[model samples]
Target: MRVFFSTLALCLTASFAQAQCGGSFSGFVNGLKDEAASRGHDRQSVDQFFGSVRQDPKVIAADRRQGVFQLPFTDFARRLISSGRINTGKSKARQYDAVFDRIEREFGVSRGVLLAFWAFETDYGSFQGDFNTLNALVTLSHDCRRPELFRPQIFAALKLFENGDFDPRRTTGAWAGEIGMVQMLPQDILDNGVDGDGDGHVSLKTSAPDALMSGGKMLQHLGWRAGEPWLQEVSVPDNLDWSQTGLRTTKPAAEWAAKGVTPRHGQIAGTLPASLILPQGRKGPAFLAYPNFRVYFEWNQSFTYVLTAAYFANRLEGGPVFDAGNPEQGLSGEQMKRLQQKLSQRGYDVGEIDGILGAGTRAAVQDVQQQLGLPADAWPTPALLNAL
Candidate 1:
């Protein structure tokens, strides 16, 4: 849910034909005033600003779009790192080289990763969404769907108003409450965004310099390491506990090489530790993902989302493909559930037998595969099902 943008815009102000929410909104303003006062913030302006809020159901539905329910890895990756994005990234690589270089030098982060984020967030400032941030957030907070998570963000948005991050009158973003060219959440914008242009203010929407540097600063804050590949194609070693290694902890490059793994580019930064992972399945590209790469995953939990960002970063850097070979058919949702149940029955301790294949389930599947003396791919297949 990292990349969700938390864009749950329950537009409390959109002119939908729903029941009149003016009373409810007025109550909310009263509550916000009390809350702000309790928090040592000025209550007058906060009340005035929140005086005219309403619920936007359209935003809620949009946030819950089925496209995100079970997006295929291949398709998600394609949508993110498209040809247009790559081309633009290349141009930006040159256009903003000075800024990027300075950022990279200061932060020890990769320009490509930072630029990829900027590109993915708002198409390098091409089209920031036109939704009203305050309206959307206020609506989401009132709605019970994610009130706890969103309510705090709404408060943070108010703080932004208090501190003058942007003019509340014209600040806009995605349907949810993300703003600017990089689509920063208000909370993150407050905490991480830096004034890169030195213009005495930071605005991600109108300042490419500020947006890019803020993005880079975020990666730095997230623990990016310089002179290290975010991720790299690697040969999965024989008998390696591939499942446990994935996104759990990284192993030293030499240890992986000792287990028959080898960097595809032979530029093994040998000093860094990497987590071995098989994205889709066996016979697919194997990657030893670095910590910074894992940080990208922190931003977007989807493997495909992070992979696309990293892959696009590489594309921007003129890096080669990480294709391992022929990939296998990924497990469908039902199949994944079945696999989880089977693993649980065999005593793997998957949290629940629900079809959601998470880290625990994948690790358990690997354990089952190892015990069964399979190819050790850790993939759920008909044959593996037959074993049960």
Candidate 2:
């Protein structure tokens, strides 16, 4: 009996050792190696790629701690689309007029819009992040939170390596695996990359024209309509119906004009379809978002971010600043989380308890404001949290 018990303990110890080894980071990478091989990637190359990768905790932390969605449009825009950035974009448009002219002629995407993307993505190529592309993508793929999204990106990166478009040792980018001056992901690099500089290779990191042309091609593929406005700042009358002040409702310019909505600068043609966006509620700036605005959302999901890009693009083209009054500051992350919790407790579907206040949270805030006889502008404030 003693011998049998000793043998059983030894077996259990071996089993635990095996489990620990299989659960290690190296083990996870090995599994990816096999998966890549099955997907027809060269085995030697896969091994070479995996050998150089180290899991990046900083990348994982950044993915989990994004707070940009919580910032108010005014604060976000003011920080990103400053006068310096606008002037730089304008100068770049002229400095690279030959390149921009060619890209626009080919892709039908405006130079200002492409420059806005460049400025926003990496400060006009001044900084394009420092994380290793392979490390970030592999680590993100191993994480279970969104494996489906990042796994394909890993394969796409591997394909880029195979095609000589990326070097695992030298390919560094955003924590989320976006590369180059315009901050495109590996999948986008494979799909929309263009050889703009006549180098016979699409090198977005080293070549400005390549990045710009690739970005322009992407925008064109994403349905950017030539000669269409993305959005314009506008004034909303106090007597206008508050229920129709969000992206969910759309109306012709004539209908909005009849309801006392007009451009802050000049009259808009009545034939255009537009939706009102009160980024800061009725008290702050408003915008009339046109159909071309959807293409901006396709580039970046944050309404505030897309709006900033569009506004910066317009500024690059010599447009005026918003005539609407400056927006009040938005809630901090802690305040936003508290508001989301309160809304959830009150039977509003604010989705996750994460601090980012997205469309669902905004809608819930609007419902609460309506119930409490408040202004119902859907904008969260300290007072709104206190009232709840």
Best by lDDT: 2
What number of clashing residue pairs does each candidate have, in the order they appear? 8, 0
Which lDDT tens digits does candidate 2 get at residues 279-316?
88887888888888877766676667778788888778
RMSD of 1: 5.8
Clashes of 2: 0
Which lDDT value does model 1 have at 101?
91
What's the CA error at residue 333 for candidate 2, in Å? 2.5
Go through the candidates in order and give each one's C-alpha lDDT.
0.70, 0.79
Flag regions of model 1 displaced more than 4 Å. 5-29, 237-245, 333-361, 367-378, 382-388
Error of 2 at 379 (Å): 1.0
